[model samples]
Target: MNPETLLLMGLGAVVIIAAARWIGARTGLPAAALLAVAGIVYAVLPGPNISLDPHIVLTFVLPPLLYSAALESSLLAIRANLRIVIGLSVLLVFATALLVGAGFGLFVAGATFAAGVAVGAAVAPPDPVAALAVGRKVGLPPRLVTIIQGEGLLNDATALTILNVAVAAAVSGHFSLPKAAGLFVLAAAGGTAVGVGVAYLVRLLRPLARDPLLANAISLATPFVAYYIGEQLHVSGVLAVVVAGLIVGHDTPRSGTGASRLQTNAVWRLVDFLLEGIVFLLIGQQLPAVMRGLAKYQTSTVVIAVAVTVGVTLLLRPVWLSLTQAAHLLLRREDEGLNAREIAALSWAGTRGVISLAAVFTLPLTTGAGEPFPDRDLLLFCTFVVVLVTLVGQGLTFAPLVRRLGLRANEVDEARQRNEARMASVHAALERLDDLEEDEPGDAPTIEALRGRMQERLRRYEHRLDVLQSAESDEVPVSEHYESALRIQRLAIEAQREELLRWRDAGNLPDEGLRRLERELDHEERVLPDRRE
Candidate 1:
C-alpha cells in the first residue's frame, strides 16, 4: 500500500473505532460490528481501493491480537472451566463441523464431504475478542464470561485442525480418519510443550534484567517466539501463543516490577485496540471481493446458503448449551449453572470475527488439477455473510436482552460482604499494631498512629455495613453516616497508596512490596461498590 493510502486507512480506522466505541457504549452493540460497518461503507464509496494481503494480515495482525487476548485472560478462571471449555471448544466444534459439512455436501451444493467440512470448520469458532467485548457491556455474569472466553480461545485450534485435515483430503482425493486423529493429538501436544518450554525460559530471563522497559520488551517478544516455534514444529501456533500467555500471566508476580507490569499492560492494551479495529475493518473491506466471487451462483441460492449457515451457527449454541447444562446437573447437581439471562447472553454473544476471516482467506485458490478451487468464492461470500449477520444483528440487541433479563450485579449484597471483609482485616491490623507499640518504645508514635487509622477504617466498614443492612425506616440517617464513612476510607486508602509509591521511589521499600500494597488497594477499590445510582 502507498503511504497516502496507508495514512488514509489508518485515519479512517481511528475515526471508525472512536465512533464505534461511543455508539457501543450507548447502544450495547459491539464496537467491532460498528467498525466492520464503517469499513464496508468506505469500501462501497468512491475512494482509492485498499487491499491487504491475507498472509500479511495473518502474520502481523493475528499474532499480537491473540497474544493480547491471552495476556488479559485469567488463567485461574480458565482452569476452573476446563471441562466446559474442552467440551465446547473441541468436541462441539468437531460435531458442528461434521453435521454442517454433511448437510451442505448432501443437500445444498454438489460438493464432496471434505469441501463441506472445510466450510464448517471455517465458521465454527466464535471470536473471543468480539464475544468478550459485547458480553462485558451486556453485563454477562463473570462465570458465563469465563466459559465463553475459554471456549472461544480454544475452539480456534479444533476448527483449524479439522480444516487442515479437510483441505488435505480435498487436495489428495483421500481421507484417513486414524491418521487425521493422530495428527490432531500430535499437533496439540507439540504446541503445548513448546509453549510451556518457552514461557519458562522467558520467566528465567526476565528477572536478570534491571530496566522495566527491557523486561517489558522481553515479555513482548515471548508470544512471537512461542508462535513461530509452534509453526516451525508443524503445530498449532495459536494454541502455543495462548499457553505461553497463560504461563507468563500466572508467573507475572515473579518477574514483573510494578512499573514493568503497568507498562506491559498499557502496551498490550494499545496493541489489542488497534488490531481489533484493523481486523473488523479488513472484514468489511473484503465484502466487495467476496461479492465478486459469489456472482457465479444465483443470488437467491447464495442468500439461502448464507442464511442457513448463520441460523445454524446461532441456533447451535443454545441447543449445545442446554445439553451441556443438563449433563452438568445430572453429573454434579450444580444449581449455580447459567440462569436464563446468562443463557440468553451466551446465545447472543456468539459473534464471528478475525479467525473466520483468516480461515476463509487461507483457503486455496486452485485445486489439484490446476483449475480454480471449487466454490471458493461462494465459501468466502457465505463466510462474510455469516459474520455480518451475527455481528450486526445479534450485537445490536444483546444489551436490551440483558436489561430485560435484569442481569445487573447485586450492589447491596456485594457492598455488605466487602465491608464485612474490610472490618475483619482492620481489626486484625489494629491488634498487630498494638503488639508492635509494646515491643518497640521508639516506634510507639508510629504504631499508635497506625492503630488509630485501623480503628477509623474498622468504624467506616461497620457504619457502611449497618447502612446497607438497616431497616427501611432508619435508612436515610444510616445512609448519610455510611457515605461520610466511605469518603474517609477512600481518602485513607488513596493516601496510603501514595505513601507506598513514595517509599518505593525513595528506595526505602522493594518494588514487590509496593506491588503487594497496590494490589491490596485495587482489591479495596473493587470491593467498594459503585455508588452511582
Candidate 2:
C-alpha cells in the first residue's frame, strides 16, 4: 500500500512474469494460468498479499489493456464477422446473464433475483486476454481469432451495463425492464459517439503527433481521455475505450509516421505484458478476501451454486453458437457455417476474467435502507469460482482441446498467399522505377541500382512461392548455407558498427554522423528475418 511496498511488489511481479514467460514457452503452458496459480499459492503461503481494488482495476487497468487489444486486432476481420461478433458479444452475454440469474435465484439460498442477476452479469462476458494469448500460440484460424477478439473487446460493455442495472435494482429495491433497456441503449449510443468524437479530435491534431515521442504519449493518453469523457457523460466508458481502439487501430497505417508506429507498438507491448501479468496475479491473491465471509453459507449451498453457475456458463456457449450458425445457414443462405470443431473451440475459448471480478467486487455493501446487501459475499465467492473455472480451467486446456479437435490453421497456404502478394507488390514497384529512370536521366545510376536490388528480391520471392507450392507441410526450411551467409552479413554489420563507434570515440566523427551511418546498417539488419518464419 505504501510507496516502498508498491515498488517492491512491482519488481517482484516483473520477475515472476519473466519466469512465467520462460516456463510457458518451454512447457507450452498458458502464462495466465501459471501466474494465477502462483498468486494463489503465494496468498496462502504466509507472505504479503495484495487485495484487488475494483475501482483501480476497472479504471486504471482496464482501459489501456482494452485499447492495446483493440489496436492490435484486425479491423477488417472483425467487420467481416460483425454479425457473429454481435451475437457473441451482445446477445450471448445477455442470455448468459439472464439464464445464470434465474438459476441462481432458484438454487442459491438467501439470494434475491437482483443479487443473482448482479453476479450473473459479472461472469457473463469472456475475458479476451487469456483466450487470445493461447489461441495465437496454438495458431487458431484467423476468423476464430477475430471472433474471440471482437467478442472480448465489446462484451465487457454489455456485461457491465447489465451489472450496473442489476446492482441499482438490488440497492434501491426497484426493478424496471423498460427503463433498463432504455438506459442500455442510451449508454451504448453515447459511448460510441464519445469514442468517435475523441478519435476525430486526435486525428485533427496530427501535426503534433508526427514526433514519435509525442505520438506515443498521445496514444497512451487517448484511451483514458475517451473513457473519462464517456463516464463524465454517464455512458459506458468500457465501450468508449473499445471503440476508440478499433478506430485508431484501423487508421494507424494512414495516420502514423513510420517511427511513431514502431515506437508505439513496442511501448504498448511492454505495457500489456506488465498489466496482464499483474492482473492475473492479483486474481490469485483475491482468494482470501473472497473466502472471508463465505463461511456463513452452507457448504452444500456453495457447491450447488458454483456447480450450477459453472455448468450454465460452459453449456450455454456451444448451444448459442450452434443455434446462431444454424440460423445463419437457414436464412442468410450464403455464408458457410462453422464446422463442429470450430464451434467447440470457440465455445471453450469463452473464458471469463478480471472484468468479471472487478464488476462483482463493486456490488454495494448495503442497500439504500441500510440493510446489508443480499448475499453479497456469496455472490463474490461464486463470481471468483466462475472466473477460476472459466479462466484457469479453460485457459489451461484450450490449446490441447483445439489440437484434439484438429482445428489448426493451414500455415502453408497462408505463407503462399503472402509470397504471392509480395511478388505482385515488387513487380508494381519495378514498373514505377522503370518509368522514373526513363524520365530522369540524371538519376540513372541510382535508379539502376534500385531496380537491380528489387529484381533480385522479386526473384527470391518467386522462388519462395515455388518452394511453398511444392511443399507438403507448414515447415519453411532455410538451407544451412543460406543461414551461414546471413550470419556472415550480420558479422560484417557488427564490424562496421564497432568501427563507427571507434571513429566517434576518437573524435573523427560527430554523434549525428555516427547515428546517420548507423541507421543504414540498421536498415540492412531489419531486412533479415532475425526470428524463424
Candidate 3:
C-alpha cells in the first residue's frame, strides 16, 4: 500500500473505533467485541483490507500493550495471588496445550501431534482485554481482576515459547522434551533478568526524565527497548516487557515528578486506545486471508478440526480451574480457594484474542525437508475460529455471566478503605504542618489555616467511613451533601475558567497565562472522585 492509502486506512480505522466505543458505552457491550465485528464487516465488503502480519504484531504491537497493562496493574496484588496466577498463566496453559494437541492428533485425520501442539500453544492463552474491560465495568472483585490481569500479562510468553518449540519440532521432524524444558527455563530466567536490569536502568535515569516531554519519550521507548534486548539475547520479549512495566510502575511514584507522571500517563492511555483498537480490527480482517487457504480441506476435516480446537479451548478451562481448586484444598494452602461461582466466572473469562491469531499466523509455509508444514492452513483456520468464538462469543456474554453469578466488587468496602487511607494521609499532613510551624517561626497563622483545612477534610472522611460501615449492603451509600458539594466545586471551577477566558478575550491575560491557570483547574477537577461512584 502507498503512504496515502495507509494514511486513509488509519483514519478510517479510528472512525470505526470511535463509533464502536460509543455504541458499546450505550449498550454495555464490550468495545473490543464490537470492534472485531466491525472489522469482519469491513473485511467482507469490497474495500481494501489489511492482512495480519504476525511478526509485526508480535514485535511492535504486543510489547507496548502488555507494558501498559503491566504499568496499570498492582504489583502487590499480583504477588499476593501468585499461586493462582501461576496456576492459570503457566500450568493451566501447559495443560490446555497438551490436551488440545492430544485431541487434535488423535481425532483430526492427518494432523500430527507437533502440528497440533503448535496450534494448541496459539489458542492456550486467554486474551484478557475483552474480559478485563467488561469485568471492570461490571465491578468484579479486586482479587479476580488481579488474577485476570496477571494471567493475561504472563501467559503470552508461555504460549509463545510453546509455539516456538512445537514449530521447531514439526519443522525438523524431531522433538526433545529435555531440550524444550531447558529452553523454557532459560527464556523465563533471562527475560526476568533483562526486565529487571532495564527497569533499574530507567530508575537510574530518573533525574533526566523529570521533564514531561523527556519522561513521555523514555516511557514510550522502554517497552520496545526491553523487547529488543530480550529477543537479541534469545529470551522471551513478551515477559521482558511485562516485567519491566511492573517494576517501572512500582517505582514511578517515588522517581517521577507529578507533571511528568501525568503527561506520561495520558500518552500511554492514548497509545493503548489506538493500539488495542487497531489490533482487534486487524484480527477480524484476517478472515478472508485465513479462509482462502481452507478450500483444499474436506468439509468433515474442517468440522472436526474446528470442533477439537474450539471444544478444548472452552471446556478444559472450567475443568482445570476445578481441579486446581481441589488440589489447593487438599494441600491445605493458606490462601482461600475459589468458590464454584468464581470458578465459573473465571472459566467464561477465557476469551482468546489477537495473540492467538498472530501466533498461529506465524507458522512456517514449509518444513525443513521442503515438504509443506503438515496441516498449516487447517491450523490457521482452526486458530481463527477459536479466536472468533472466544472473542466475540464469550466477550459478549461475559458480563451477563458475571451478573448471573452475582460476582461484583464490594464498592462500599472499597470506598471505605480509600477514605480511611485519606484520613491517615490528612493526619500526616497535619503533623507536617506542626513541624513546619515549630521550625518556621513566622508561619504560625499559615500553619493554623492549613491545619483547619486538613481537620475539616479528615472530619468529612470519618463521616463517610461511618456511613459506609453502617450501609445495609455492598452498594455505596448516596450522600446528598457530598454530591451537592462536588457540583458546587465544579461550578466554581467553571466560573473561574470563564472569567479567565473573558480576561484573555479582553487582552487582559496572555494566552500562556490563561493556559497555566486552566491546567491548574483541570488537575483540581481530575482529583475529584467520580459522582457516579
The sequence of per-residue lDDT tens digits that candidate 1 reaches over residues 1-533 is 68987898778788888788888788667788788888899889987655656667656676677677777778999888787788788877777777667766666655667776777788888886776776676555677778887887778877888888988887777766677678878888998898899888987887654477897688778878888898889998878888888888788877767767776888888878777888888888887888786667876667656765676787888888888887877788543566656777777777788678788778898877887766788778778887888777776676677778876655466556677887888888888887877888899988878877778767766766777777453222336555665688799999999999899999999999989889879868756654521
User: For model 3, where is the 10-residue window of minimal lDDT?
Assistant: 173-182
Q: Give candidate 2's TM-score.
A: 0.94
TM-score of 3: 0.98
Q: Could you give candidate 2's per-residue lDDT for residues 385-408 as a string of tens digits?
A: 988888889999999999899787
Sort by TM-score, best first: what order?
3, 2, 1
Best by TM-score: 3
How many collisions per candidate?
Answer: 0, 0, 0
Residue 450, candidate 3: alpha-carbon lDDT = 83
Question: Where is model 2 more than 4 Å wrong at Cα?
Answer: 477-485, 498-523, 530-533
Report the lDDT tens digits of candidate 3 across residue range 144-238. 99999999999999999988999998888776666766888899999999999999999998998889999999999999999999999999989
Give lDDT per model, in order.
Answer: 0.76, 0.87, 0.92
Minimum summed lDDT over a 10-residue window in model 2 is located at 524-533
Error of 3 at 296 (Å): 1.0
